[model samples]
Target chain A: MKIGVIGGGQLGRMLALAGTPLGMDFAFLDPAPDACAAALGEHIRADYGDQDHLRQLADEVDLVTFEFESVPAETVAFLSRFVPVYPSAEALRIARDRWFEKSMFKDLGIPTPAFADIQSQADLDAAVAAIGLPAVLKTRTLGYDGKGQKVLRSAADAADAFAELGSVPCLLEGFVPFTGEVSLIAVRARDGETRFYPLVHNTHESGILRLSVASDAHPLQALAEDYAGRVLDQLQYVGVLAFEFFEVDGGLKANEIAPRVHNSGHWTIEGARCSQFENHLRAVAGLPLGATTRRGETAMLNFIGTVPPVEKVVALADCHLHHYGKAFKDGRKVGHATLLCADRATLDQRIADVQALIDA
Target chain B: MKIGVIGGGQLGRMLALAGTPLGMDFAFLDPAPDACAAALGEHIRADYGDQDHLRQLADEVDLVTFEFESVPAETVAFLSRFVPVYPSAEALRIARDRWFEKSMFKDLGIPTPAFADIQSQADLDAAVAAIGLPAVLKTRTLGYDGKGQKVLRSAADAADAFAELGSVPCLLEGFVPFTGEVSLIAVRARDGETRFYPLVHNTHESGILRLSVASDAHPLQALAEDYAGRVLDQLQYVGVLAFEFFEVDGGLKANEIAPRVHNSGHWTIEGARCSQFENHLRAVAGLPLGATTRRGETAMLNFIGTVPPVEKVVALADCHLHHYGKAFKDGRKVGHATLLCADRATLDQRIADVQALIDA
Candidate 1:
């Protein structure tokens, strides 16, 4: 089957790579002819919002999906007229805006931090007063990797935060003081069968994800799966979805939903029974969902900005390095290294081994 | 670095897939535009024997490799003037002809079956007298998967056997009373580092590979590694290589050397720390070799001729199905399914599960 991916990025490249072994073909749609997915399949150089090009892609592929949520809902709806879009246009519409996504989580009885929509400077002030100090002001749309968001640590910070965002529609979320952050990599089939990978503990540096360690020790592992299951059922979601959460006090609080394969789940490629990319293809292809069994204690380290020297990384016995073919720039996710081991202790050692190399 | 592959079959397709994550690009040189690897990367529609096309490809890519040994050695030697041909044109020259390969193995002090080159009917008669009944007659070149070889059960079968092969340049071999067949998948790097994956016990049906199970229990496992290491050192080979061997009485006899990834090693996709394809790419790209550590007890079942229903194989928790997207024909390797388990018992059960599926 031919699949049309609306964005040409590392995610699309990975999905294309995963699809090849299954005899599935991919066509990447992007304005950048040098997009990484171009290395894997046919890259159609056109704007994502170009209706003519989108329709042309729809005409060629059996189904359509996107690697990024920033794609305009109108463009997705337009393509849906020609072919089925997995995860639905509705999911994309909700996920595109922070306000709508958080509201949906609240309505579904899923746990999320207290949040209020801010439309203007006055609204932002009112929201800060209600949510209290140390809140986060974020643009309602197009925010990722901690961009387009500002933390209001003091009342003085809130006044400049609204001006900083240029009066865009936004959200003021009450910060949840948490023990640690975790995410659930879940896939919901078209048949409504939902599967969850083991909970992954994630660490961030300067608001960018640095490491992800798959663990069964999260106190809310069962609760996280339950929360993800309810969300999947509520949205009638069909495809790989990731739900980020914060461990606040003794419970889990929803952080956000990524309705696609995520970075934290990258370890699945080497440490699970089936990779998230492959399973995502299987689900999108209408194939039966495979089991989500972790192969071992797994940890993944992002090779941000610069890839570590190969000699250092290769010395680790069970580590698998994946370098996404992209020009290296500061803070860019150019690649990743996944370490699979028999136990957490060994995995931790491997993590230290890689960390030392990165430091060097 | 860019690499040019001469064939666009599964081997080439896999090489392209492995090369992409390493920031290496590939151009497949094939006459058929729709070859499988064509979808994976840049594909140049050119005949392998065309000197102009071969030179263009050599000038375009950093290195050149062939997915199959059937390519004429003269074509490879011509390309080598402009680009490095890995495994060397000499390796292909030796491996393509049965008599040359067997003679080289014997001269190198490697154990091979007792055999003699046969170019005429008189030579065949002499070979029968020396090797006796139950011997095999095979073409000197261009044969695989039980093709181009016939067994002589009695003296009466010899005269017609010569006619059956169209009386091409051939070899007659005395069949060894072997207990089992095993293979070693090894990679020799440009830096002269050689790594070997664990020996895999293989079973064939109707001359087609039916099953492969990795075993550390094979008595000749170390011997196989030592033998393969010597071959790699002697050839100064670079890239993934495989050696097929027969376990006879108490020792191993070398059968053949495939200077590329072998089908029996497909289990490495899920059963080893680094897959043979990835290792081959690393070797050719001059990157450090990856770990050859086996993940666990593993088995691979070839999906020849047809793909069994997914339900039949999906029950095994760790079973991975790889469908190569080729049009199926009688005795064709359309795809394979690999099952990774914690122990031998689990692997046996998984194999039984797949066997039941094929039986059904």
Candidate 2:
């Protein structure tokens, strides 16, 4: 099968890596002349909205999927006319914008933090009045990795928020004072069958994800999957979907959704029966869902900006390194490492060793 | 590091697949215009002995290795003048010729079948007299997967053997009345660190391998590893090596060695902590030897001449399909599937199901 990917980043690179062994061919579309994934398969160096290239890709491949959530929904809708697109243009439309995603969650009866749409300074004031202080003010669309969002801690913060955020359509969400953050990678086949990976605890540094550790028996797993199932059913999703949630006072509250392969599930490459990348391909290709059994305790460390010396990483026992072949720039995720551990103690020790190497 | 490969067959394809995640680049040289692995790396379509192409490959890559044992030792020797090649020309020379390989085994105090050199019909007769009847006559070099050998069961069969085999440097081996056949995959790093995968029980039909099952606690494992260690030490071998053995009344007798990845070790792709392909790359790249711990019971089924429907194979739990992307012929190995089972009962059931599909 020939698969057309809409973004040529590490996620697309990994998707190709997983799909090649299954006898699937890939072609990727990205704006970068040297998208890192170009090495793995055909790279069409064209803008996502470039009609000629989009038509060329759609004409060549059996189907289309995107790695980047920010890929404009209209682009997917346009290509869907020529080729089937997974997760659907509607899913992208909802997922790319915060206001729509939260509204969808509320309509589906999924638990989420109190939120209100903000269209003007008066609307912002009303939102602050209704959602209260210490809320998150975010642009309605195109925000990721903690970008395009600010915290309104008080009245003074809210007064300057609209000017700071450029008076754009936005959302005011009451912050969930949580004990931890968790995310679920859920896969749904075209036949409506769904499977969720074990919930993972995520840690962030300076608003960027730094680590994710899978907890198969986390107390909130059932609640997390329940919340994710509603979103999947409402979206009628047909591929991998990542739903982030906050563990507030031991209860789950929906944070957001990413309609594509995600970083939290990267550990599955070495720690599960089927990797998230492979599962996503399997789902999008109309194949049976693979087993999602976790192999053991696994922790994934995201390498932002630079890939550490290969020797330091591979030398560690039970650790698998994935270098995405991306050009290094500050705050860009260039690679990741997944460590397999037999128990919590070993997991802790190896995590510390890898952390030391990354720090050095 | 950039790697130069001498043959772009399935083994080379797998090596590239395994190495790419390590951030290594590959260039392959093969005579076939449609060498399928070419799609995965830099492909230089040329004969293995083409010095110009070999020079170009050596000049461009950090190290060179060959997947096919039939790659001429002289080619490796010539390239060594420009860049390092693993499993040195000396190793290739010994491994390619049955006579020299057997001699090396004997010199290293390793047990092998009783054998003698055959020069002519007269020499064939003499070999029968010396090694006794029911012997096998095989060419000294460039033989694989049931090719280039003839078995003699009686005195009358001996008269036509030389005529059948034609004028060639050959050997007459008194066949061991063995109970079973097994092989070991061993690795030696540049630093002389050596590790061996557990001995695997192999079953062959018409000299082409049909199945390989890892027998972790096989009684002769120690004996097999010990025999393999002798060969590695004597040759100072680097990279992965295959040592096939014949089980005779609960003991082991050496058969032959392949100085590259072996089909019998394909199960390691999913069943070992470190795959043989990864270990081969690590050894050739001058890295530490990876842990060779077998993950669980693994059985690999070779898909000779045809690949069944992907759905049919993958439906079985823990089965991994590796399609080689080769053009199929009557006896060509197009791909393989590895089955990971938890116990004897589950293994048998899964094996029966997969075998039924293969037989179908």
Q: How well is candidate 1 docked (DockQ)?
A: 0.63
Q: List the candidate 2 regions with Cα displacement exceeding 4 Å.
A: none
lDDT (10s digit) by residue, model 2, range B1-360:
899999998898899888888888889999899887776789999988899999999999999998988877679888999999998888999999999999998898888899887888888898899999788999998778978899899998887888788778888999899999999999999999999999999999999999999886888988998999999988899999999999998888899999999999999998898899999999999977788888777889999999888777766788888888777788999999888877868877777888898899
In model 1, pairs of residues that clash are none
TM-scores for every candidate against the unseen true structure: 0.97, 0.97
Best by lDDT: 2
User: Model 1 off-target regions past 4 Å?
Assistant: B310-316
lDDT string, candidate 1, A1-360, tens digits: 899998888999989888887778899999986798888877889987898899899999999988988888888889999998987899888888999999998988988988999998899889888889898999999999999999999988987788798778999999889999999999988889889999999999878899999986666889999999888998899899999999988899999999899999999988888889988887887888877878889989998899887656766777877878888899988888898898888888899998988888
lDDT of candidates 1 onward, in order: 0.87, 0.89
Interface RMSDs of the predictions, in order, are 2.2, 1.1
Deviation of model 1 at A345, angstroms: 2.0
Tell me the tens digit of each residue's lDDT in model 1 across B1-360: 788998987888877777777777888899985687888877888888888888889889999888988898889889889988887888788878999889988988889888999989899999899888899899999989999999899988898787789889999999999999999999999999999999999999978899999886566878898889888888889999899999988899999998888899999988888889889888887888987778889989998888786545554577887767777788888888898888889899889888877777
Candidate that scores best on DockQ: 2
